[model samples]
Target: MQIDWVTVAAQIVNFLVLAWLLHRFLYGPITRAMERRENAIRTRIEEAEETREQAEARARELEQERAELNARREEILEEAREEARRLKDRLQQEARAEVDELREAWRAELDEDRNEFLAAMRTEAREGFRTLADDALRALADTTLTERMAEAFAARVGDLDEVDAERLRGAVRRGEGLVITLGSDVSGALRGTLTAAVRKAVGDEVEIDIPESSDDFTGIRLKAGGETLDWTLDAHLDRFADRLASAFPTEDARETQDDDANGGRGAGDSTLGDSHGGTAAGGKGQASDAREGAAGDG
Candidate 1:
């Protein structure tokens, strides 16, 4: 085959024209559009990746906050429980102390009541014993003889102190003599013995007037000329008190010596009886108490 140069040249010219036309109409636009589409897809993929990362970070922060919140709740609950326990213990302690105080107070009140009741009972018993003694003495007087009593009484009246006899005389009329007052209850029974007691105290020649009073006044009242005497049970009690001068038993002899010394200082022993239940100077003892208290002031 002969080389077709003309034909080849002609064909090459035709292809060139067609290529230029395609580039202008189709290739150029297709290439530009494909490049723009690729850029848009790449931008979308980058935006999706950034959005995922943001979501992961947000999840981590939320989980950390939840853990802290849980811890705070646990601490608050523990504090509340501890406070409640402390309150309960304090209430219990106060209750126990109150109960103890009440018990002590009740016991003290009961003891006071018991002591008061016992004291009242003791006072009543003492009164009853005194009442019984009064009843017994009255019985003895009813059975004694009267005639023999008169003789004995006359003897006692003569022996009593002159001053004591004088106080008894005060009760008698001017012409009469001294007087002796016996208890109305025991007058008859004591009449003989008391007369004997007085006769033994004063001299035998003294006149006697024995009268009875309701109370215990086993004493003489004498009113001789102008002077008067009073010897009563109250006076005897006063004298008996003098005998027990000091409470100490060691002072017995000293008291007797003082009584004698004081007796020597005065004019004479006007007092009835000796220290052992003798007659006193009746009312003179009231004045002598001042002297005895001064002189025998041991």
Candidate 2:
């Protein structure tokens, strides 16, 4: 342990010098490099946060677009369905109207056919009855029947009204001359009787002309000017035909005949009956009486 104060001071100076060099060269450079690295890391973190927020905003926009598209699709589908329903209703209505029109046309055709058939049947029946009656009358006719008819004609002339008598007288004065038409020739005695009756009714100077027997009719017709007196079997048969026609009238005529019947009007009167010397009812009775009397005399 000798005294070493100088050696201690030299060692303290060396240690101080070494500390200063290490601080200047190592500690100062390391601190600056660490601060730069920290700043770069903070910038990178801020960029990442901004990118994430942008991505979230884009996702929200895409979701909204998808929702709008879905709504549009639903609306389109609903519109299509409504249009289809409307079209179906219109088609069904048109089809029903066409079917109704066809049915109505068929019904009208059937009605027309039915009316035609009925009219044909009526015409055939009327003609057949007329033919049969004509044959029966021809078979029953005889000379005696002709004489009785002539007698009936003479009686009818005697029963003429004043108006008819005056008309005949006027026609004779005008020189039209009376014409007596007969269905068949009568005996001389019957002719004379008819002639006497005509002279008694009119003036004896009145000319009476009797033509040859005509096959066109089966009755007696007396013509003077425009007036004619018919007392023919054909006239009686025409009244009967009128009655038959009224009984079996066509659809249109039946309605009118029914109306007239309800009004208490006779259906048997016709132009043929009017042409005779009496009303239809009176002529019918007289015709029946004449036939009976002729038959009894035969």
Candidate 3:
């Protein structure tokens, strides 16, 4: 433990120098490297925090977008429902209107048909009553007024115009001169009256061919060799029909002509030379031609 001051001082100096060297070469370098590593780690942590904040903000924005899309879908569904309701209401209204229109049309048609049927029934009833009354009057006249019947026939037939009256009178005056075939009955009282009227009207003597008795075929006949005028009930009927066809051309016209032929008037097809009578087929003229010379005697 003896004191060596010089050695002790030298050793202290050497220790100081060693410590400096270590700080410079080893400790100083280690500390500096550790400080650099800590600084890099802190910088990375700051970048990670910024990135996380950005992710959170992005997630909130996406939620808002999803909410807007749901709202848009609901609005579209509501619009579709409204459109469907409007379309349904329009179709129903149209169908109801069409049904009402059809019903109205059917009702009008039914009313027209009913009215026509009633009119036809009324006309038939009137015709029936007239026929009954006329038949009764004829029954009363047959016993009491045989001459009156002749007078009545002459009067009715005489009402024809001058031309028609002349034709009938001419046929009656020249009666028997035109007979080709002879039937069972030739003359009736009505036939005689017509013959007498014809002589008076046309100033010609008419000789009539009359059969013995009235039978199936009956009428006054006039014949002259080849030419013949059959005032038979049947022949006069056909001529009457042809004449009516030229005039009114109705079904009753045929029956009326038949009656005239049966009553002893020769109803051959008569032509009117004096009058300009139009036809019903042309639809240009009235039925006034019936009162003209075309239907003269018959």
Candidate 4:
């Protein structure tokens, strides 16, 4: 309680000195270390925040890439499916076309074979009939077939109508005289008879030539101007063959014959008559066959 100003002032001074020393040595260094540590920690925190932001951006980019990849895969699968569908359609069309081609080829081959067989049968039938007729005529009649044919021709010439006789006379007068072609040789008596008949039909001024030749047909053929007269055994056989064909006709032949019949044409008209009668009829005017007039004699 007693007042001591000097001592108290001295003590105050000492305390001040000690506080200054502590501040300079311990407090100053410790405070500066703490500030440095805080600054370092702050820098680390800022760096960590920046790294987190970068990672988030990378994740967003990855998610976008994944979506794009999924879309590309779906597109590729759809393209493959479309390609497969197109291939299937093309294959089916090709298969159908191939089958149709093969079917057509098979049908053509079958038709060709059938036609060949029918033609062969027809040839055989014609040959067989010719052989049979030759044998029968030789056995039944004491005369050769050629001689009988000539007799038939002479008879036909003698019985010619006025129109036919006039036409033959005109042909003989206008062109090269009448020429008679025979399949085989005839006796002098038969030749004389033929000559007389021709002379009676036409005038005696008309020249007549009878040429004997070994022809394929057993018949007589007369040529005057552009006109021809055919009376042959082959013609009779052809008529018989036509009748036989009518009895047993193929599908195509039957249809044709039916159409011809409906159009007022006879079956005989469509056939190849005795000794190329159809040809003579078309190329040169031909007289009617003598078989109808002298059937019994033949």
Candidate 5:
């Protein structure tokens, strides 16, 4: 095919003009629309990505919150359990202390009651024994016991200590006469025996006198100058009562009785004469000049 240069040139020029027109109108508008659409899509994609990141952050926060809440719950539960244990132990301790205190109080009460009972029994027994002894001695008053007692008492009087003997001797030298007083119940034989004993103990030439007394005891009392000696059955019995009181004293009276015993030595003590059974030896040799002072009137 032969090429026509002018027609080809003209056709080329027309095509170029048409392409330019399309570019300026249709192509330009289509390209701009497509670019705008692409921009919008990109914007939507970026927004979706930002939303996804925010969701992920929110999920992480929720997960962390849940973990912390779970940890807090566990800790609270453990604390509550420990508190319960401590409370239980405290209550148990209180209960044990209360029981021990109650037991101690009961024991103290029992001991007090026992001591009271024992004291009461001791008092009863002591009273009973004293009554029995008094009755028996009264019944046996007129027996050989009296004679033997009188002899023993006279012997004790004869065995005076050096100090008492000296006192009696000095009193005899100063005094006018010796006085011998006998209990009203004393027998004639006893009076004669006592008179002989006095003469022997004093001196062969010493004065002897026997006087009557309104006492109920079968005892003798001797007076020389200002010195007096009593050896009465009543006195012996009183000494016995004192000994009995000491031996069976109660708690309340023991302190008082102990003080009395320690304060001074009484007659019938174990030192001068043997007073094993409430018997006291009463005698001393002291008489005035050689004159016998008849006791009945003088």
Candidate 6:
């Protein structure tokens, strides 16, 4: 129970020394290491935060790119649709044009065919009529036609226009005479009458000659050197046939014949009607002459 002051004091001093050693060697160094660890952890946390922020920014950029790509795809699709529509319309227009062209060509060909057929029919008709008339007239021909035809032909020379008269004069001048061709021999009286008529029509200086021809045409041919005028029944018939041909000409011939037919003498006014009348009258008269000749021969 009594206090030991030196021992107590020594114990207190040792305890103080131990505390100071721990603070300098162990506690101070441990405290410094803890602070350094704390600082390192803080730096690592800041770097992790920075990395996360960068990742978030990158994600936002990717989303924006995806949106842009979708918009561009839509635009391309619309453009493609418009181009297809344009191409379809162009093709349809071309087909329509081709169809129209073909139709026009077909119509033109049809018209040409029709024109050709009509022309052929007209030609056939003309040829058929000419053949029939020639056969009928030849069958009905008789001897008394000689004088009547000669008289009629001689009178026709007097009725010639200035152009025909001039042509005859030139031909006569060249040949030095006028030649009268007959279908058959005529009586001296008829010959004299025809000779007088020719002298009256032509100049008195002209000579008249009658020649025998083998052709069966019942008409006259007046020739002067190279120029010969056909005033025969065959010629008249040919002219009539020509008129018939002209009246119903083909499509190609109508334009030419229309102008000629309108300007020149028609079938009725020209020698066509007159020639037929003469032929008919001469045939009847020749039939009567045949009866008389037969009676005389008997």
* Best by the TM-score measure: 4
- 3 against 5, candidate with superior TM-score: 5
Worst 10 residues of 6 by lDDT: 286-295
Could you tell me the TM-score of candidate 2?
Answer: 0.40
Q: What TM-score does candidate 6 get on C-alpha atoms?
A: 0.34
Better of 1 and 6 by lDDT: 6
Residue-level lDDT tens digits of model 6 in 1-298: 9878998999899899999999999999999999988888888888888888888899899899989989999999999999999999999999999997887786667657765665555555544544555566566763245555666766766665565567667767776677776655677787777778777766777888877653455556665555455544453344444555544445545545557678874743565576556545554433334333323433
Cα lDDT tens digits for candidate 2, 91-123 = 999999999788778666755775565555455
State the TM-score for model 1. 0.30
List the candidates ranked by lDDT, beginning with the highest: 4, 2, 6, 5, 1, 3
**Which is superior by TM-score, 1 or 5?**
5
Give a tens-digit lDDT track for model 5, residues 1-298.
Answer: 8999999999999999999999999999999999999999999999999999999999999999999999999999999999999999999999999997886786667556655655454445444444454456667664443455457556755775555555556666775356777554457787667767765666555576777554444455677777666654443344555455444445445456557668865732553344443333322221211012212212
Question: TM-scores for all candidates?
Answer: 0.30, 0.40, 0.31, 0.48, 0.32, 0.34
Looking at model 2, residue 283 earns an lDDT score of 48
What is each predicted model's overall lDDT from 0 to 1? 0.53, 0.69, 0.52, 0.70, 0.62, 0.65
- The TM-score ranking, best first, is 4, 2, 6, 5, 3, 1
Return the top candidate by lDDT: 4
Better of 2 and 4 by TM-score: 4
lDDT of 4 at 12: 97
Residues 41-136, candidate 4: write the lDDT tens digits.
888888888888888888889989989989998999999999999999999999999997887787667657755655555556555654565577
Least lDDT summed over 10 consecutive residues: which range in candidate 5? Answer: 285-294
All candidates: CA RMSD (Å): 18.6, 13.3, 18.1, 10.7, 16.8, 14.7
**Model 3 residue 94 distance off true place after TM-score fit, in angstroms:** 7.9
